[model samples]
Target: MPLLAFWESNPDEVSQTSIEQIVAMAGDGNLRDGSLCSDELRQYLTQSDTSKLASYVEHCLSNSFAKGGQVLQDLVNELGRRLDFKVANGRYQGTVNAIGFDGIWLSPEGHTIVAEVKTTDAYRIPLDTIASYRRKLLDSAEIAEPSSILVLVGRQDTGELEAQIRGSRHAWDIRVISVDSLLKLIQLKENSDDSETGRKIRSLLTPMEFTRLDSLVDVMFTTATDVEATIIHSAAEKAETSDVITSKETSTTPSGWEFTDATVLDAKRVKAIEALAKQLGTKFIKKSRALYWDSSHETRVACSVSKRYTKGSYPYWYAYHPQWDEFLGEGSRSFFVLGCMDLNFAYAIPLDILRKNLSALNTTTTERSTYWHIHLSETSNGLIALQLPKSSRQLPLDDFRVPLDQS
Candidate 1:
């Protein structure tokens, strides 16, 4: 990856042309007109431990090629391997550079399954190729009914392909599935450890990592469930009763502020928010999953929106919902920010943000570069962070729009 560090740092160097060339070269198994599958390249890679070499292979596949032929085939092979595909030694033609047949499997029940791996954005396998795979599998064993599966990686329009396959008059049966579908099958297998049939059903269901942590934290509040909303509302009510948020300071108290049951922020709403901010014609830095700019009164505006908020915390998920702080390389210039959770009550500022401002500052923690341990009881300057007035004009937190120039 260091070989690409320089180019990746300057996005200008990684043009569409270079990306295409990289993908082609990856499929061709070449670098600098030299074959990476050659003994020399293999020796060089072998100089490092297998794990590092595997990482390097993955990096090259993911970063350089954007995923391609041999790279995709290896992944497909690995998926089959990890799942303990009943058929071992499933190679065909024994091509070098991992360019052999994608995979050939014999399910425990004696059904032969032949798979063809593809990593193109849009590709249509000819009917002849499907026939050839069926013939090959039948020849390899005494199986009566042989089925074929086309495993596509990153191809978005697989539905059309599947339909075409279904309609085709090819001699044998064939099914088209995206790698994502296949992965779902694998995951279901992992989850359903009840019986072999259950696991196989998972395998048959078909299948998929990567995450945007900052974006995830920002959307965390949007996905909060009804139960979670009840808890949050109860917390707010307790604060009000305890005079933490005195009724005298209330401006626009919300009665039932909740969102529909959705865990992910809608993409269209995110675009709308961005477009609105762009209309303001002010430069705003988008970082830490929050939009940051200075308000009219010199107060820093750190605002984020949650289109969906799930009810519970997932593994590696930061807590405190809309006002969550993910010390994982996320920093805040604004002490107390606004959380637009599920676009319910625009004035219903998140308690977590307030808690963050009042709690001990962020410090190093396991999953993040910085993490905060917040408690609502903590306050500053004799002000109860949670009890802050829900005003329309008193502060910049009331509006649902991005604050770019404090307007």
Candidate 2:
């Protein structure tokens, strides 16, 4: 008998025939060239107009539930705003894609608290998926050690959403709520029509479904066993080390310092200043005399000298005192008791109070004792002097180590 006639006679066998045909055709070398003999079956399935089939496929893919993922994402974003939590959705890490929740809260002792969020539907919550999320939480050290809160939401049969608090562990808590409640909250802030619609849809979800969802939420939120803080810390440390190495490799030495002047400018000192500048940018300026930088707004820094200088006696030293008055002004502020040092050493002083303090310093050197000397304000353009030793004075301006200007 012919294959179609035999299959028609034994209807139950027809399914197997189609499967075998597909498998055989798929394995054939000529399959790509459309030479495989599946035209009869293809024509049967496609007997309907192509446009109709396309429309049917599109309709299937565009169902309400299929589109609900975006609604959920929006809800997550809104919740984050209300709770001051950081929320991100559809993030991919390695082969896995997930939503990330981050936030900081104050503990009873004022310590910083952190939290995470996850979601599920009426269907069974997969253990592996929950575990994977927990693993991710454990991997992010900044969020791992802080107290965590997990939130689960469910839709109800009555078309009204409901919420349940699954559990709370020490600083951590697991909570569940319905979309209706969220809508109501939103309604309180805005329009009532949306709230009413939300309430209606929330009513469709059964309580039992929500309860089961709450159980999953509880497990995900309350259970601390899945996440290990130590693991996260270790990972963070390693990552930090790797980042340090990578940074060193990519970083170029600043152009301002030359070799001959390098000795006068302590490599360690310049690096420290550069590091500060890198972090604070132009907000900080290094005081040439004190060998320390000051915030732009700060004026006088408390400095001590081991030996008081007799003003006229050290006439030659006046040139070395650094045009302090040029950089620091009279209106600058002062910090107290920074340290005791010698005339040869520089002290960081605020720009505003420089003149007031300079006037206060005793002109004559007393016993080799600590005394505060006011820095002078000299520069109008808020330039802090970087003093080089006399021998290194001629070094090019490019030899001074300064941070690259990102601005």
Candidate 3:
């Protein structure tokens, strides 16, 4: 409860500046004494001076460390307020910091948006917990008639919430939507609307995360390259456990599954990699680009998975250089290639092997590190490979390692 602790310890700080003001001050690396934040959060906030403001919002919104009911409510309230929606119902008891029940937004489209912001994993709103909201919306026939929905800002799956609502014996009202997905959708709406008002609205949106989310959706969902990559990746998966390498006798692969750059930047692949990491009982990092890291191993390895139609030639394996640079800069030494869509396998270069090779092949280090073309086709049994079967429940981490250790 660092969040709580920080607040308690820094009553003076809390009183002097608002969270946003603190964030702004932190961005300037000027967080005064008695700041209500942990060291990690302080560091992150300080770094925000160089990063986008939206980065701060995304970090706060997504991370476990920066969350609380009040925190979530503040963010949601700001989002709704900035979206120019009227709070038909809100937990804001008006004492500036006293938060209450929840918020129901009356959108510009006359739709009532119910936002349940929860940062605690231990807390899931039960059917009974939502009765007040249901009554609030239903009792007011005028508000209920206008496309009301309970958008769950949850840390986990809200499918159960949806199912519960659907199965309830009442008016078929208040559909459920994920806050992250809904956030993206709302930003998408803002992006799609090219009107002057839309432009003005975008300019006015605070914290810059709304704009950032919109741009991310625009690129990942609407951009031409991302679309092609996603399509090719999907088709390749449906076709087979992608053979990323032909019999090219690559240095990285024994089966000649050539280590090439295939950009799998979709959400599904990311989630799959994350789930696999969870099952492996290790940490997973999927953010910003085509790189995912499995720190589950003693040595963390950055990876790019294939999901494209590469035929008998090189698959469209791509390394988002910036992502790799960031990953490596974040202290990952080894790198892995995974057939995340179909084959469910990962090949790796040991840290020593990678360092030595990158040094030898390093005609241009910094420039080359920015983008990965993975040219290690020597395959002298130096590379470590991890073969992930359909079910890895019984397989220990060692089972996937090459030179298979009997121990």
| RMSD per model, one decimal | 16.6, 27.1, 17.2
For model 1, give the RMSD to the true fold.
16.6
- Model 2 accuracy (lDDT, Cα): 0.31
Q: Residue-wise lDDT of candidate 3 within 1-407, one digit each (tens)? A: 34324434564564455454444433233333233432323333222211132343455556554233444454555455434466533543333433234676765555565556655334445645455555655666635654444545544476655565667752254455444654554454332212223323333221124435775454444434434544443343333434543333222435333333332334434454444443444444432234444322133445455543445323333332344444445554444434333334344444444443342231223421333333212123433222222222111223343221111
How do the residues 236-317 of candidate 1 rate in per-residue lDDT, one tens digit apiece? 3333222222132223338533332222322322343334434443223222223332212122233333222222221011
Better of 1 and 2 by lDDT: 1
What TM-score does candidate 3 reach? 0.33
lDDT score, residue 156, model 3? 46
- Provide the lDDT at 194 for model 1: 23
Q: Residue 137 of candidate 2: its Cα lDDT? A: 58
Question: What number of backbone clashes does candidate 2 have, counting pairs of residues 3 or more apart or in separate chains?
Answer: 48
Which segments of model 2 are wrong by more than 4 Å?
1-66, 90-94, 97-120, 142-144, 157-173, 185-407
Per-residue lDDT value at 30 in model 3: 31
Top model number, TM-score: 1
